[model samples]
Target: MINSKFVKQKEVSISVPPGIDDGQMVRLSGMGEALEGGVPGDLYVKIHVRKHPYFRKEGFNLVTEMEVKLSEALLGADKVVATLDGEITLKVPSGTKHGMILRVKNKGVPLGGNRRGDIYIRISVQIPEKLSKEAKKLIEELKKEGL
Candidate 1:
């Protein structure tokens, strides 16, 4: 509550609706200043959503980046991803490229009723900085094989 010359300062708890966007307003009737003979005005509260450390919101969907090893990108591997609900195992298909997006259904923001959005996982392949001699030789062989 803000101190105002017309309205009295009083704290009130307001329940925000789920999946509400930032800068959206929530109106509370009869929560504002009371006139001499008129009804009380409505109070509007603007919402501001804090940025998450990892997840980014798009509509109701949540997007996040996951780093995978080069070998894992080449060969299929099971990867664990953190969602708003919890951690889930995602299968990375073989030959998965960098920036590949994998969608996990029903793991995103909750819509009205029992419906929910999905989570998109952006894949980031991490290549080895240094390689052993044998590893380098195998890579050279792969290069010769048009890899």
Candidate 2:
């Protein structure tokens, strides 16, 4: 019989092997017995396999990082896709500052009962990894102009 006081809390994903019946009584080795019964009782469990990538906190939106090209960052494009999901394009405004937050209402996590959360896009400026001679010369010219 499983002990009643041995239950532990878990936050991450857990997979139950196939052929497990729904509403079946089972206990983890460490998880204890169910209440009201001196003997061990079947432990209740809920299984969910997949989840979205973003984690949300109240009063704050969350999204993965995405780097914009120098021209894109300077000109400020209309939308930039998130790295985790390329199809989810987040809009950007002109003169967007680095780390600027763009909030999309109701584009976030599901709060149940048909309610949803928000999504935020953080702007990032990207620099070229390897600069061609012409690019380097342009940078030098810009430096001369104190730009």
Best by lDDT: 1
lDDT comparing candidate 2 with the true structure: 0.58
Clashing pairs in 1: none
Cα lDDT of model 2 by residue, 50-103, tens digit: 434543344324465556677676666766454322356565655566787777
Top of the candidates by TM-score:
1
TM-score of each predicted structure versus truth: 0.90, 0.51
Local accuracy by lDDT, each model = 0.92, 0.58
What's the residue-level lDDT of 14 in candidate 1? 96
Model 1 per-residue lDDT tens digits across residues 56-102? 99999999999999999999899988888778899999999999999
Clashing pairs in 2: 3-32, 3-33, 4-33
Q: For model 2, give the 10-residue run with minimal summed lDDT.
A: 18-27
* Alpha-carbon runs more than 4 Å astray in model 1: 1-7
